[model samples]
Target: MQTIQTDVAIIGAGSAGLPAYRAAKAAGVSALLIEGGPHGTTCARVGCMPSKLLIAAAEAAHAAAHTAPFGVHVDGVIRIDGREVMQRVKSERDRLVGFVIDSVNSIPSGDKLSGYARFIDNGLLEVGGHTLVRARSIVIATGSSPVIPPQYRALGDRAIVNDDVFEWSDLPRKIAVVGAGVIGIELGQALAHLGVDVTVIGARGRVGPLTDPVIKAYAEQTFRKSFRFEARATVESVVREGDEVHIGFRNEAGALIHDTFDYVLVTAGRKPNFDRLALENTSLVLDDQGVPVYDPLTLQAGKHPVFIAGDANGVLPLLHEAADEGRAAGANAARFPHVTPLIRRAPISVLFSDPGIAMVGARHGDLKPGTFATGEVSFEDQGRSRVMLKNTGLMHVYVDRQSRQFLGAEWIGPDAEHIAHLLAWALQMKLTVDTMLEMPFYHPVVEEGLRTALRNAVAALQAAELQAA
Candidate 1:
């Protein structure tokens, strides 16, 4: 058995783990990154990068086909080569992975070992072939895995999850996407645009159910025009018969209707990957869902010299949130006096569906009875969205009616990701609603949509007061 020593041992090399490795090195701490698979985070590998590439290719093909309606006529048939699309997706994934490896190797500190990382006890990690690595502090950044329902496990390759969806050499002739969450809706729409007969099945009452109602409605409308969508359908089971995968759903009449597809893509949400890790051997406590429980401020797991970040902590599941938590964990692990951290600001979430969905701070449901005000603006008011034919989206702002401080912001529209950042920063800096109104934002741009949303919030707040009087 080989024995290794480090100041900090980081498990998982995804978004959170990689950043933690860098943070530890920057603080002059000896760190070791333990990854179960090849380098690169989910965003760089299967989750974000490949999915977005597939969407981009699909959108391009759709655009080319419709170019004739826009007065651009081409004599030839616009075709989609699924094999070629997968090749591009794989190439991009490989390039990004290579870049990450090169950067990590160049660091000249902290080594990466490819293997499953498990906790032998507090502050000790067992990795690849009986190699034991001990550190003064351990950071668990093990990400999450797709949640596969028991009924669909047998379908395996025929009915795949996001992890193996892009591995196909050719896209399916028809695909049934289960769970109309962000991934399912986006990929289903993209596949439909690429000429695949795609059907999106939402087990919930509506698509994008975790999102704001306004965003959810807009997404449903957009998806309706692109592919077949069924909401509030409960899936009983999935069966693979011959070359076709059949999904059974209970309709409103309580009768099961089976729909068959060449393939089935399941986006039923993801579960933490910590099950393989022997966390029971350590002092670390896990929640009922098998995720580590950590102090939201310090991200510490109990009194043990171990920290949790990323999906493992289950604090925030998004990639950016994982990276932020990782940065904080790594820096604190390397700190001398035993560190404690404060929540810097609220977390933000962004979805990459057509017209996108971005949210920062809290939602209306998260608020209690208080002197609060809500505001919204439509993308119809934005020149950029209007020109891009993306007028179906909306921007929402929440503020304290009395203090006028910015509370939160949510948008589902063009450039929502970029706009959310500014809103998040403003909220964190304690910028008031009046301050945002006075700020200068470029006209004829998508960014200006936020300003309009803020204005609406103010007006709506005043209107509510007038009604009360």
Candidate 2:
């Protein structure tokens, strides 16, 4: 058996782990990066990058097919080549992954370790079967994996996850997408636009991460026109047929629906990769979900010299959050007893469905009633959206009734992704509705829609104040 020692050891060389290793090294500590899987981060490999590539292709196809409203007409049918689309997605995805691989390759060979790491005890780790590692501090950034329910697992090759989609030689004829979360909605819509028979089945009334009822309802309505969507599905059974996956569920009309698809794409959500890390051997306390109890600011696991970051924390699964958490966790691990807390960025989430959905800061469910004011706008008559012929939109902005400060927003609109960032910045700066209203709004722009929502919030707040007085 080989023995290796380091000041800080980072398990999993994905997005979070890579940043952690870098931050520790930047802090002038001996850092070692260990990985049991491939080098490319989730974003590069099967996540944001590849998914966006597919969406881009879908957008192109959709635009070509729907240009008649803009007085533009295609001479013939716009054909989407499934094999070509998958080829480009995989090719560009590989390029992005290659960049990440280059970054990992830059690390000195001595500072890198190969193999899965398990905690032998606090401050001690056994990696693979050949090496024993001893470190003063450990950073767990083990990313996450797709959770396949046992019923779906029995479908074998007939059932696939989001990662499996990127590997397709060609798109399937028909696919049943389970879970209408971010991944499911984005991929389901994209696949539908690409001429695939896609059915999006979601439990509960969830549509992406939307909590605002109006926005959620508006989003659900908009997507139903594009694909078969069953929000709050009554599931019967998910079993395998001869060469296909059979899905049985009750539709919105309470009609029993039996369908067979080339694959059952389960987007049930991802489980953080800490379950196999032997966390029970450590002194850190585990939550009901078996995740380490850690400080959000410092990322310290209990009082031990261990830190948790990325999807392993199961707090925010976004790439940007993972990177930020990784840097914070690594620095804390490198500094050990002198760990410092970091002020995190305001929360932001966006789903890349046509007429995208965005959520920022506090959710509607998180806000207490009467404590906040809600403002809304619809893009059906918005100038730029009308010009672009993408008038399907609904937006809701919220502000603290007492403080008049911007609280958060949930919206579905044309270019909602861009709007969400603006709202996130406002939330972080703690800007008031009046102050936001004072900001510049160029005439005939999508951002003008945001200003209208902010104004509505101010009026609503005033009305509430008047009612109280």
Candidate 3:
């Protein structure tokens, strides 16, 4: 068995692990990065990049088909070649994955270990069966994997997960999507637009990461138009019948429903990948869900030299959050024994569905009614939305009633991702509602919709003050 020594050892080389390795090296610490899976991060391979590529193709096909509304009639029928689409998506996805792989290869061959790492003892790790890594500090950034229920697993090849969905050379003509979260909704809608008969089922009545009731309602209305959606649904069973899969579920009203499809895609959620890491060998204590209890600010695991970052922390699963957490964890790990406090970025989440959904900072339910005021604008008739023919959905901004500080926002509208970033930056900078309202809003732009929501928040606050007096 080969023995290796390093100042810091990073497990998983995905989004978080890579950054941690770089940060530790930048801190003048000898770092060893170990990865068991493919070199490309989840985002580049199966999560974000390929999904968006599929969505973009779906959007183009949908747009070409709907050009009649713009008085641009096509003489021939527009078609989507599923095989070609998937092939192109794979080609481009591989290109992006290659970049990350190249970056990993650039590291000294001796410093990179290609294997699964398990904790043997504090600051000691066993890699793949051969190499033993002894380090002063460790960073666990193993990330997460899709959660597959026993029922779905029983169906085997009949049911697919996000990872399998992207690799398919040809998509089924009809499919059932379980769990109306980010993955389900995005892929469900895109598939529907791409000429597939898609039915989406959600255990909860809401879709995406929506917590704001107003935004949730708007999202439901907007998305239901593109695909068949059933919420508050409970899957009873899944069975394979010849070439198709039959799914049984109970609707919100207690009515049993059954459907047969070419395939079933499960996107319930993701679980941390630390189960294989033998964390018990370390001093870290895991919660009931098998997540390490760590400080969000420092990403440290208790008082030990071990640190947790990215999806492994099970806090925020977004790509950007994972990267930031990795950097902090690496820096802290490199500087262990002499700790430095770090502040994490404000939370931001986006679902890349048409009339996208985004949540920035505090959610609507998190705010106390009387202490916080809300402002809203409906995109149903917003100029830009109307011009783009996506004139549906709403935007809501929450502010502190007294200080009028921007607390957070949730929206379902055209370019919600971009709009959410604007609000995220404002909230991070502690911009007040008044200052946001005073900023100039461009004409015929989606930002005007945000400006209107800010104005509404201010008005609501003033009205509340009048009522109190």
Candidate 4:
């Protein structure tokens, strides 16, 4: 076996790994990047980019067919070519993947290793019996993989994950998506808009990432009107009969429903790729979820020289979070024993569904009772929303009752992606509800709804103050 020594070793050359490698190199340390699989990132390969491409196609079809309100008439049926839709998705997906591969290829050939690595001991790695690396520090940026429930295993070829969706040459006629999280809702609704029979099943009455009960319920109701959405579902059996998959479940209303679909798409969740790393050989402390107990600020795993980042850390799995975590971990690993904590940005999440869903700063469940007041707005009556014929949405802005500062928000509304960013900035800046109301609001725009929500919050705060007095 070949023996090598490096200052830092980064496992998995995906989103987090690439940035970690760069940050360590920038810190004037010799770094090695190892990959056991494809070089493309989850976002570029199967997560964000391709999913958005598919959603774009879905949006186009939906727009064309639903223009009757604007008095625009299409005499004939609007036809969508499944082949063409998939062709664009695959073509654009490959282009995005190619760019990432190019970036990976630019690394010095000697610094890149093509093998899965396991910890033989703290800071010691064994790579496929071909190489033994002794590193002063290591960063685990190994990303994650789809978690397939045991029940779905019986479906055989009829069951698939998000990674398998972009590879299809043609879209299926019917698909039942299990788990109504971000991935499931985005894809399920997109497929439904594309003329497929889609049913999205959720458990525990959750929908997307919204924790606010009102917003969650509103989102559930709105989506059900668009497609068959079973919130708070209890799935009983999953079986494969020849080419089709049969699913039986009790929905929210306690109705036992049986359905057959061409495929069962599993979007339950993802598992971090740390289990294969032989962590027992290392002295890092792990949590109940089997993830390393790392400091979020420093990305350091306990008292060890190992750092965990990205989806491997099992904390925020989004691409931006992965990049930030990777950079922090790599820099800290390079300057071991003198690690610095990162000043993390305010939390923000968005789902690119129709009437986009977004959560910024703290979640609704995280707020302390008697410490917060909420402001709400309904787009159904908002001027610009009605004019655009996209007047279906609900938003709630949370504020500190005492300090009157913006705390967080949950939203399902038009232009939420943009509005969420504004809210996130307000949270990071610690802006007050009164202060946000002072910001300029343009007339006849979606953003006007935000102003309305803020004003509503101000009124609520006053009402609470009066009752207290």
Candidate 5:
């Protein structure tokens, strides 16, 4: 067997792994990066880029069809060509994927290895069948894989996941989407707008990762206008029937729902790819969920030289979070003998469903009721929303009642993603509610809605103080 040595060894070449490799290099550490699959990052290949491409196409189609309300009628019918749409999505997805692949390729050939890496022992990794790597410290960023339920496996090709959905040359006429989380909602709504009959099933009564009740309710209301939602639903079984797939589920009322569709797309959730890593060879002890115990701030796995980051940690699965974790883990691994604490960014998440849904910083449930006050503004009458004819949801901001500090925010409204980022930055800087209100909000813009919400929060706090006095 071939033997190699390095200061740091990074497993997986996805979003997190690449950043870790770069950071380790920047830290002047000798690093070896390994991957068993394609070099392109997950976000560029399957998760974010391709998904957004489909959403963009769907948005264009929806815009053209709905322009009649704006007194702008198309001279000809606006028809969706599934083949052309998929082609365009694939063409652009490949370009982005190629860019990531090129970046990975730019690494020195001697420092890059292509194979499945398994831990044979602490500080040692066996690659593929022939090579062994010994490193002082290692970073695990193997990423995650889609969770395919056992019941759906028997249905064969009819059961699709996000990894398979983007590759299809033609979309199914009807699809039953399991798990109305971020992936499910975004793809489901986009497919529905593109003329695919879609039914989204959520195990809970919520869609997306919405924790705020106000935003969840408004998001569900708006989403219902685009497609069918079977919340509090569970898939009992799935069977292939000739050309179609028949799915059996129990609805919220416990009523049996049997439907036949062209395909069943599973977006239930994702689990970290730890099985192949042979982590048992290390001193790390995995918890009940098979995730290694580690410090969230340092990303260290126990007191050992091993570190876990990105989706592999199973903490925050968003792309930006993964990137940040990768950088921290890489730097820490490079500086192995001495550890430095890193402050994580405030949590920010967004679901790209029309009238986008977003949450930033602390969730509503995370805040103490008496300590915090909420401010809200509905987009139903917002000036910008009315002008754009995209008014549909609401924004809720949470603030500390006594300190007037902005705690967090959740919004289901037009351009909530952009507004969420602004809130995230403010929270990161520890900005106060009063300070945010003082920020300029251009007239007839979505940001004005945020200003209104912050103002309302201030007013609510004043009311509470007056009652106490």
Candidate 6:
């Protein structure tokens, strides 16, 4: 029973914990990181990286399929070896894991231990066997786990989650995805392109409902063509019968339908992973859903010197937001005054589906009447967009009509993720529309779309003024 003392003990060596480890060490604080699993977080392992690989393979297959129509025909000789593709995916995943390990190992005074850790008392954690660690402060960055509905949990090898999708050596023949959120839609489309009969079921109006409606419409349009997009539909149940998985769902029309598939993937949502942490002994506040409650500004739990960040805090579950929260908590825990700025700069959320969706600053409902105005330009009109063959999709800009400051922007089409950062930076800097519209951008680029969207906003302001006068 060796007892070790440290200045800080950080739990979970994912995105948030990794950054917190480095920052704490830089601030001259000795920290210990405890992880139950691997080094990299969800984004590196299960979430962003693997999903994007699936999407890239899907896009390549789509291009190969369309090559015949563009005068380059391979004449009936094309095949995708699922096993080989999966091997490549694993290679990429391993490379990212190596990168994370290198970064974490670079922290001078940070230590990582592998085992499920539990809170013994205030600022005390028990890892592995009798190794007790006591610190002045504790940071919980345990992150999240995939959501599996009760009805589908019994199907062992037939039903899967996004986390297990990468482990399959072969793609499913017919698959049913049980959520229309970011993960489900992205993976569903990718599988559909890989020759899988993919059907998506969701009790929502559209895919990626949290995104701007305009962006949602674009995703719905693009994805519906390849996969069965069943919106406002509820999945009744899924049962494994023989070698197939049987799925039942009720559509918006209240009609019960049944289908059989080789696999069924559930991506409803993710909740915090705190079951084994033994938080009951400590004063960490937990919500009804078992998620830790922490002050968003300080990332500190209400009762103890312990802090929670990332998905554990449940403030904004995105990876970037979690990293920002972790950095702030680590810096402040080392006696530096922490500031949680009023996220006036809208953090852009991007869904990298076939036609990517990007939204910055404020959603449509976040703006106030008379304070803000919106202007949009269709992707059909942009020369660069036309060349890319994306004649659909929309780009929307929100502006403070009175102050002429750009509030935010959202776009769904090519280069959306890269284009979104410009608007986010502008909103963060409180830049006026006049300032944005004056900046010069290169021609025949998606960036020019930003300038065009801002120009349209300026035109709308002028029209409003003329009518008022």
Most lDDT-accurate candidate? 4
- Ten contiguous residues minimizing lDDT sum, candidate 1: 203-212
lDDT of 2 by residue, 1-469 (tens): 8999999999999889998999999999999999998989999999999999999999999989998887888997788899999999999999999999999999999999999899999988999988999999999999999999898888999889999999999988999999999999999999999999999999888999999988999899999998999998877998787888878999777889999899999999999898679988988899898998988889898899999899888889999999999999999999989999977899999999998999999999999998999999999998999888889999999999889999999999999989898999999999999999888889889999999898888889889989999
Instruction: Please provide TM-scores, in order, for all candidate models, with all chains considered together.
Output: 0.92, 0.98, 0.98, 0.99, 0.98, 0.93
Per-residue alpha-carbon lDDT of candidate 3 for residues 408-433, written as tens digits (9 for 90 to 100): 98888889888888888898899999
Q: Higher-lDDT candidate among 1 and 4?
A: 4
Q: Which tens-of-lDDT digit does each residue in 1-469 have in candidate 1?
A: 8889999888888889988888888999888888777776777778888888888998788778766545789787887888998889888878877877786677554376778977787767788767899888888888888888877779967878887877878888899888888789779888898889998888655566335666566667766888988866888878888988878888656788888898888888887787878888887677787666778888877776677888876666877778888888898888734776846556677777666777888775576645688888888757778776666687778898778889886667888778878988888888888888888887678877888888888897788789889
**CA RMSD, predictions in order:** 2.4, 1.0, 1.1, 1.0, 1.1, 2.4
Residue 464 lDDT (model 1): 79
Which residue pairs collide, candidate 4? none
Model 5, residue 445: displacement in angstroms?
Answer: 1.1
Candidate 6 minimal-lDDT segment of 10 residues: 336-345
lDDT of 2 at 284: 83
Q: By TM-score, is 5 or 6 better?
A: 5
Go through the candidates in order and give each one's C-alpha lDDT.
0.79, 0.92, 0.89, 0.93, 0.90, 0.78
Which parts of model 5 have CA positions greater than 4 angstroms off? none
Query: Candidate 5 on 110-203: residue-level lDDT in tens?
Result: 9899899999999999999789999999999999999998888888888889999989998779998988899999999999999999999898
After TM-score superposition, what is the CA distance of residue 270 in candidate 2 from its true location, in Å?
Answer: 0.9
Count clashing residue pairs per candidate.
1, 0, 0, 0, 0, 1
